[model samples]
Each structure stands twice: as C-alpha cells, then as structure tokens.
Target: MKSSTMLKAATAVLALAAPAAAQDVTLRIQTHYNPEQTSGKLATEFVEDVEAMSGGAIDIEMFYASSVVATVETFDAAANGILDCDMTGGAYQTGKNPAFQFVGDIMGGYDTPYQQLSWLYYGGGKEQAQDLYNQFGMELIGWWVYGQESLTSTTPVAGPDDLKEWKFRSPPGMETEIFANLGASPIVMDFTEVFTAMETGIIEGTDYSGLANNQSIGLFDLAQHATYPGFHSMPSDHLACNKMVWDGLSDQHKRIIETAMEKLALRSALFFEKANAEAAAELAEKGVTLHNWSAEDRATFRKAAQAAWDDWATRSPEAAALVESHKSYLTQLGLISQSE
Candidate 1:
C-alpha cells in the first residue's frame, strides 16, 4: 500500500515536469558574427538565457558567421521564413531603401552607445524604427549598439586637417561623403582586401571595426598609428523575427524574448567597452600610437556628416521622414539645433 502511494506521488511529479521538458518551439537564428568573437559568445549566452527563462518551452539554434546565407540576406531570409530571426545590422538592406541607412548606422550621429540606445528607447525611436522593419516583414526586437569604430591609419590622423588628401579604405554611402567633405580620398573596396590594399600603398588606412576587433584582425600591426574612442560610425545590430511568428507567440513568451533582448544589448555594449579599453592598454605597451581626436575635431567631422545625411535622405520618402524624426529628437535632447 505504501509503495502504491509512492508511485502515485512520483507520477504526479513527472506529469508536472513533463510540460516544462517538452519544448514548444525551436527557432533557427542566423548572425554574421563568428563563434570566436565576443559578440558571438554573448549571442550564445542570450540563447541560453531565453531557453532558461522560457522553462524549456523555447530553444534557439544559432547559425553564426553567416553560415546559412550571406549577411545582407539575413533580413529577407527571416521575412521569407527561411530563418526564424535575423541578427545583423539593418544597413545591409540600404540597397532596398535608404531609410535602412538611418536604422543601421548614423555615422557621427551619436557620440556613445548609451546616447544611441537612449534615442532608441526613450526618444521615440523604437516605434519609428519598428515601422521600417515592419515594411520588410520583420519585427525589430531591439538593437545592440557596438559603439564607435576605431580606424587603423598608417599616418597619424590627429585632426581634421590631417585628412586632406589622405587616401584610405572606406565603405560606400555616407562614410565616403563625410570623409570627402574633410578632403580625404575615400576608396571603396571590399573589406577582405583592406590589408593588401594598405600594404600595396593603394590606401593609407582603413576605417574598420572597434579597437579590440581590429586588433584581433592584425590591423594595428600594419598601420602602427590608430584612432581610439572613435568619433564616427557606430552601427546597430538588431534582433528581428518574422512578424507572423512573433505575433503567434504567447504574451509571456514574447515578454521573455523582449526582456532577454534588452539584457543582450546592455551586456554586448559593456563587453566591447571593457574589451576596447584592455586592447588600448595592451597595444600601447607594444608601442602602437592610439590617437583620440579633440572635441573640436569630432564636431567638425559631425558637421561634415550633416550634408551627407541630408543627401542620403533624398534617396527615399521613408529616409526623409526618418531623418526628420532624428533631427527633431536631437533638438529635443539639445543635442542639435535647427540652424546648425
């Protein structure tokens, strides 16, 4: 009789735990980061957090390094249901609409990751940015701003005047124009060829990843002189899911994903902050000259970016609206004035 009662008790416990053990859905997500990168490692942590918070109802399979498709195709893949989510920068879709450039990276717009995140969270960017993602058939969960990118330059770019006639590798669009305004000759080239181009004297420097990432890739070794606490080009990577799938999720699961994404963004920004600091100290010991531009120099670069931003806005109506919204919000924060 006692044994029978114990069996019943055991069965009840098993019944209660069974639901938690059975995962309701498994999401296939893809990102452009490699597994070895700090961002990639943090992304894996986010996956673990979601599963834990969902009590095993959710499982995420991370495909890193653009293994499933090219980086630019990630958003479309999520929209078409080829993948459940796209974890990449929105700038890749600028080819589809210029509005994406605003959503991706507002080069020289915000000085720090925190300010950019503030614009997204408190300054009404969340809703406005969501509309752009909705048009592409994906839901923008949130963004992880990696902070400003440092440049690897063979010549010391200590001030704006130093940029005059300086040949360097540059990405297309706003970056090219902004530097061109400063009288720098920006050469458009594939990122893979930056090292070779610099080596062959085709370019003198490359505006590349954050200091830590650039160090990992050996850019500092070749360039010798570098820029730190970069004042230009901070891009935002997003976690966007298919709207249909997102809408289908229960409110509880949706909250779990949303909350986890918020945590992921903060953690990612913090990681790069610490990593870049460490990289600077270590590189300095190795005799690399890391330059930080003066306040006046940074402002000059931003002023140059103004015309580029306005020029890009003319590419599409959506782009024009986004640019207006940004200007309005910046004015509200006293970050900009209409006359400037």
Candidate 2:
C-alpha cells in the first residue's frame, strides 16, 4: 500500500510540471538600437517586464542593431516568420508604401512627443496604423515617439532661409523633399556613414537622432551649431509581430505583451525628455551653440512641410487616408487651422 501511494504522488507532481512546461512561449525580437542606446535599454526593460508579468510564461530574445535583419527588411522578416517581432521605425518601409512615411515620420506635424503619443492611443491613429500593418501581414502591438530630432551643422540654422544652398544628410521621402523646397541640397545616406561624411566635409550637417543621442555619438565635437527642441522630424518607432504568431498567443499572453509595449513607450518618452535637456546643458558648456528657432520660424518650416504632406497624400488611396486621418485629428485639437 505504501508503494502504491508513492506512485500516485509522483504522478501528481509530473502532471503539475507538465502544464508549467507547456506554458512557455518564446519570441525572438530584432531592434534597430544598439544595446547601450536609450531605446535599446527600453527594449531590455520591456523583455523583463513581460517575463515577470507573465509569470515565466513568455520569453523574449532580442537581437540588437539590426543583427537579425537589415533595418528596412525587418517588416518582411517578421511577416515571413524569420523573426517573431520587430522593434524598429515604420518609416523604413516607405519604399514598400508611401503611406508608411505618414505613419513613421509625420515631419513637422507634431511639436512634441506627447502630442504624437496622444494621437496614437486616443485619437484613432492606432486603428489606422493597424490597417496599414494588417495589409502587410503583421500586427501592430505598440509604438514609441522617442523625441524630436535635431540638425547638427557647422553653420547656424535659425530659419528656413538658412537651409538654402546648404548640403546635409536627410532621410528619404518627406524630409528630402521638404529640405529641397527650402533650397538645401539633401543627401541620402545611411546613418552609419554620417560621422565619417561629416568628419571629411562630405556633408555640412545632418538631421540625426535626438539631442542626447547625437551628443552621445560626439556629433558636437565636429559641428559647433546644434538645434535644440528640434522643429522638424520626430520619427515613431514601432513594435510589431507576425500576424499568425500574434493570433496564436493566448489572450492573457497577448495582454501582457501589449501592456509591456505601452509601458516602454511612455518610459522612453520621459527618459529622452530628461536626457535631452541634460545633454543640451552639457553641450553648451562644451562650447556648442544651441539654436532654438523662434515660433515664427517654426511656422515657416511647417508651411513648407505642408507641401510634402499634400504630395504624399496623392501617392495612393492608403497614403491619402493616412494623411486625412492626421489632418482631422490635428484640426480638432486646434494644432492646425481647419483651412490648412
């Protein structure tokens, strides 16, 4: 009888262990940020939060700096099951669809990170973004609007007129067109090439990362003039997963993943805000002349950006719909006049 009792006890223990083992789900994620970058740290925090929240039911293995795939190919990689998730900017997909330009980088549409995040969560922007991702066979989990990007130049850029005849590196699509409108010669180059190009005088400046990130990379050592509270681009970084993989997740696991992403987004915005401010002070002490354009000057740049918006909207129905959604929201919020 004692022998029988031992067998039963062992069976019960094995049964409990079986369910625990079956609960594990591992997701492989790729990101565009290096492990030491601010966004990269946020990615690491997100993995820890999801693991803890799910009680060990979910695991995220991250590949940093586009290690798993090229930056622009992340969407296709996730869609094809090469990676389970992609933590990168959506604007990289502009070659696939012009609509991504509107989704990824709205150019001068938003003056701050919070405004863009507000629109994404509460102003119907999320649903519209999902529509775009759905067409590509991926699910839009969440996104982060890190901070405004600054222009680093050898010369002061106080107004749109200052851009005239200047040579600089600008990302593709809207930015390239917008700068051209202001009479600046825009060069399209990879982010990795910016430093060397600047060092050799191949380019006069670059509209690169946030103030803190630019400072971290020592851009100020070469370019004396830096723009603060940047007036132009605020690129939105996204977290997306394969549609089939996402659909297969249990409702509880899905919620945990989504919650983790939302938490990361807010944390990233707040972190960049503080980091950029502190970095600006440090740069000033280092002899960098920081320029914050006047409100009038900002309005002038915004007017020029409007043309890029109109041009993008005419690319396709999807592109047109995305532009309309942004205009409607901005108009309702009094950010842009209805006549605009």
Model 1, span 152-193: residue lDDT tens: 899988888889999999988778889998999999999999
Give the worst 10-residue stretch by lDDT in candidate 1: 17-26
Model number with the top TM-score: 2
Q: List the residue pairs that clash in candidate 2.
A: none
Separate clash counts for every candidate: 0, 0
What's the lDDT for residue 53 in model 1? Answer: 95
Instruction: Give candidate 1's error at residue 182 in angstroms.
Output: 1.6
Candidate RMSDs in order:
4.5, 4.0
Candidate 1, clashing residue pairs? none
lDDT of each: 0.89, 0.89
Model 2: per-residue Cα lDDT over 7-55, one tens digit each: 9999999988874333679999999888898788889999999999999
